[model samples]
Target chain A: MRELLERKLVFVTGKGGVGKSTIAASLALLAAQQGKRTLVGEIDAKGNLADFFETGPTAFKERELAPNLWGMSMDTEESLKEYLSLQLKIPLLAKVGVLARTFDFVANAAPGVKEILTVGKFLWEVREGHYDLVVVDAVASGHITGQLAAPQAIQELVQVGMVRDQTDWMIEILGDHDQTGAVIVAAPEEMPVNETLELAARLREETVVELAAVVANRVLPELFGRGEEEVFEALAADDRTPSPADLLGAAVGGPVRPILDGAQLAVTLRRTRGVHLARLRDELPTGTPLLYVPYLFQRSHGARATRQVAEHLAEELGY
Target chain B: MAARQRTASAGSVEQLLAAKEIVIHCGSGGVGKTTTAAAVAAMAAVHLGGKVLVLTVDPAKRLANALGLEAFGNVETQVPRQAFLDAGAEPRGELWAAMLDTKESWDDLVRRHAPDAGTRDAILANPLYKNITGRFVQSHDYIAMERLYEIHASGRFDLIVVDTPPTRNAIDFLEAPERMADFFSSRLLRWLTVPARSRVLSMASKPFYSVADRILGSKFLEDIAEFFLLFQTMYKGFVIRAEAVARTLADHRTTFVVVSTLESAPVREAEFFIDALDDRGLHLGAVVLNKVLPPWFLDEGTTATAKAMVADAVSLAKVLPEELGSPDQVGRVLREVGESFLNFQVVANREAEMRAELSAAPEVVASVPYFDHDITDLAGLLQLGEQIWR
Candidate 1:
């Protein structure tokens, strides 16, 4: 747990719909439970994170969802205004009225402004030291590279100024491997895994951030061994024979053939579960610590589910 | 034997190029839009003897890798000069490629086209303008339009092939330049500039002035004033340029090549994009259905058991129309899978259907079968070109 606290930022990213936000929220919860002031930020325009906290969309302005844990969905416009004021030292009063309105229009009109503002906001929060840990549920894979490079892009575009100064600070924070780590979350499918690997390669090529670990979510648990095969064979044999009325009580026989039919079904289910689990283990990155979250029967939304996930992560993170 | 089905007439890549000033290739993600765009440009250059430029907005950098170029930047790099020259014809025709750097290009546009230095400085200095234009604006679309304008203005390339982002993003990118230009030119923005303009005329008491001064701190207020003034001057030029590109896009030579896969979603997205093109009055060159699965699965005897199983399943359900049966069910599934391969002939034979409905538009020019291996290099583009032009 102390080793986990060594890093200031944890970026949980993966293919779209691969439970990234859930993992990010869980990590933040885990950190906060350890008494670290943690903040989880979501850059998705859909604002799905609010649902994770059992809150409404309007409840987005970094309210504490749990003890020592605050959450925010990146509000591009508001964050842009704050960034402008703080970095440029623009007086707060002067930032409003006509000037602010014009700024809003211009910001909305600018290319990559939404992405830059979103990333810039995240970078700002990271540099501000307002929290011991900040977890960003960044935009999906399609735009993540661009999102990650927003600060650098802004730095180059603005070139020598307060904007550049902020950019410099962000680069330093991100480049520090001990302070920043990225977790690539993926499912046990071909397309998402391929995309995740590609993303991992790209992140390695582009950023100095280290790959912490890969979280393979909703993995099926291994439930059977080779010993279950005999049960299936006995079930097959029972299907060929007529049901004996006294066979149910004669389970102590030498053959040990069960008169009950559901035993084979149980064995089959166990075997199928084992095969899927084995395949998942085989496909996952070897030697890299893999955290397998069991498939939830209920939708894993809201605080309760998030807490359950956090518990799983706590065990995986060796807490 | 099955009726000898004709392969859809793939309109010569050259013919399409000859016709459009701006040819936009659009499709769903992972359906080979980038490679197809490259092939079209390559074909237009090598076979047609015309200069061609292919612009890609895919952040994956696959386009650059496809052309064997080191990297895709805002500037156009000659394709033949890159490592993938073997893919082109001997005495290769001129092919240019550029990658869109949305933010930088937007800044460059602001600096280059702003009405005056004061206005430029003010707009650049204003944090709002800086953030909006730099980050929020759909840089890809603007840069694509800007790149087109630059290339079109340069008269260096006879045809420009633009590979739009995957279907959803492609539509957004195409609509972005106009949307962004309109946002900057809106009445709301004009009204927002009033305070900065009236600053000199207002002369109340010291406290009142101080309050107003605090509200519109002279520096920030002046920067906003400068942004509007400069924006006004640049707006007209930007609008005209966008319109010119739009007009070029609308021109007969500017063909909208809607690419798609055999998959239902990609096909559906392609259909939607075609509708969008029609809505914009953009010329539909042809639909190039890529990665189409072949229909031989039904004709083969080895798959007979599976076909029979499907038929039995269909018959037992009794949900299918009476005209559909065991062999027919197999054929229908095969047809659905291989629909892209047959789409061109189907569409051509039913021209009246296209005319009857607005959505039923565009002629199918070619159908390229799905490749066995992933298209990660120039060789893949060549293979795609062979299939497209065959």
Candidate 2:
């Protein structure tokens, strides 16, 4: 996992709501804590990392969120402008009213253009060698694959020019096993884990990127052991109510009903979660390390909590 | 309990289903949007007695599995009647499921909108068309919505539940028609097509063509010229259909149901969507907060009793070996369960607070407690439906 972190560019993606953004933030924080300058690029204009960092929404330009951690929210429109002006050498085309009007049409006509621009910009950071690591909080699995495969796809279509030359560089960096890798985030549940495996297969087939690590979020703790399982089964078979004689023998006090119900719910939830965990382990490719992050029951994932997650990952990853 | 009361009154998901013809479930990924859509479709068919079609543009196949469909296709397929019955649903109306095939839909749209067979065939065979239709950013979203409008107009299903892709793509699904309209009306295509229209215009645009050919290759310019001419002939119909789709989306019967979770990121994404939908004047009726932790039984009156039980249970566990099992194991299990109940309360309260804050928004927010397992079967979906309507 640490070796996975050593890649110059780490693209993080998974099924939505699996805490991909949080995992990216945690990984970035951990890398930074290891004395590496890390830049985490968020794909949407709305910055989720801002909340995790407990800062204002990340600006379009990169800004330091922590000592060695920097964050930037990638707006496709802004990236298009930047790409046109800087990479394509058409500084005024992206600004002119008429051409800008055409920009939308062109962008729509070429779907991966925006994706290419976003990914190109991220790869550009890696090319600049300004940071030790570039972590991208990517879009959901299917689209993220499109983004990762964009350079090669476009290169195959376009035969010549600066765009081709630039994509060549992207292909080189992305295909370099030691330089680029992707970390997939998944929950312990079935669909997310299944999607994670699917994404891994797609990445292996379509892109030149490596499947680095799988981070399973919200893994519930074990609440029942072998003996306890038998005990719970026996309890379930018996009537829930205690006999009058038994109540008198114990001389117990307080409201027992709620506690008993809570215990039952807890045991059921834990037992079910264990099944999912087992499936995840069984389905995942053998020898591919899967890191489990315990469920953190909190109201908000503010900077403090994000750092706490980072600490947990750091410990598990042996950073 | 108080929070649940407010959410129940803010807007009933059941009422939203009964009232609306189209229920669009838009949210970020992994928030149970697919499950919510499937459950809503099932509920509408069984409880509301309306024929329903649930379409998912998400590339993931979870919806098919969630609906317990043995097979799913680009075309709508009826969910097995036996599965619905097994789930204890008295489904009076039909439930159909489909996954979007962007390429197929794009091809169909071009064929329908084209002026003639030759033009349509030419457009279909164009390499640029193939690449653009398949790779374009909003093409998938746009085509899904186009197909949706077509299906809705056919009057086959009384209710259409859409489980959209991730946030950006879902937003694109809403705005795609407008983008299509803009593209059809843009000046660049008109200029590009001028060379193919008239010999005089071709001569007049020779310098422009020469420059473009020099930069992009003569073959590329020829391909563009051919594509533009074919596209120009069909532009009117395309614009009209795009505008019609936009109008259909804004229809009062069309309601956007945002599915989110208690996480700040998802909640924030939901807020962004709600605000965007409001700006567009689209009706937003319900916000489904999926996988919320259930509240504990402890409240002000019960807290003292719960604490007393914890103490009593711990003491009784220490002496339980004499009566039942090993004292150490019994004591450990009792203490862990007792302490874990408190932890559950804390998690539940935090989630409740977040739900309360979100409920203050204009849309009705309904919550479904985090299930013990993934809801990938019809019975599980029915269970979620009951919770949503509960």
TM-score of each: 0.55, 0.89
Q: Which stretches of candidate 1 lie over 4 Å from their true place?
A: A1-142, A145-319, B1-15, B28-30, B58-73, B81-92, B101-112, B116-133, B165-168, B194-232, B261-271, B290-294, B297-302, B306-361, B374-379
- What interface RMSD does every candidate have? 18.7, 4.1
lDDT of 2: 0.76
Q: Who wins the lDDT comparison?
A: 2
Q: How does chain B of model 1 score on TM-score? A: 0.72
Residue-level lDDT tens digits of model 1 in B1-390: 122223365345555566667778876665667778887776666666667788877654656676777676877888754444565445256778887777667778888888789777877776657545544546556667767767777888878888875422447766766776776678766654665666554342233324324433444445545566667778787877776766666666667788765433345466677878778887787777665533332223323322332334333223322332343442343222222212222323233222223224554357686454546666677667766664
Chain A TM-score values, per prediction: 0.80, 0.89
Clashing pairs in 2: A16-B29, A16-B30, A111-B136, A111-B137
* lDDT of each residue in B1-390, candidate 2, tens digit only: 234445334557777778889888888777888788888888888888767998887655666776777668789999988889888877988899988888888898988999999999999998788777877657777887898899999898899998875646447779989988887787776776665665465565565455444333445445556776777788899899999999999999999988888777777678778888989999988888988865554364445544554566556655433434565555555555566667677677776666776666554667798786667788888888888874
Give RMSD (Å) of candidate 2 vs. truth: 3.8
What is the clash tally of candidate 2? 4
Going through the candidates in the order shown, the clash numbers are 17, 4
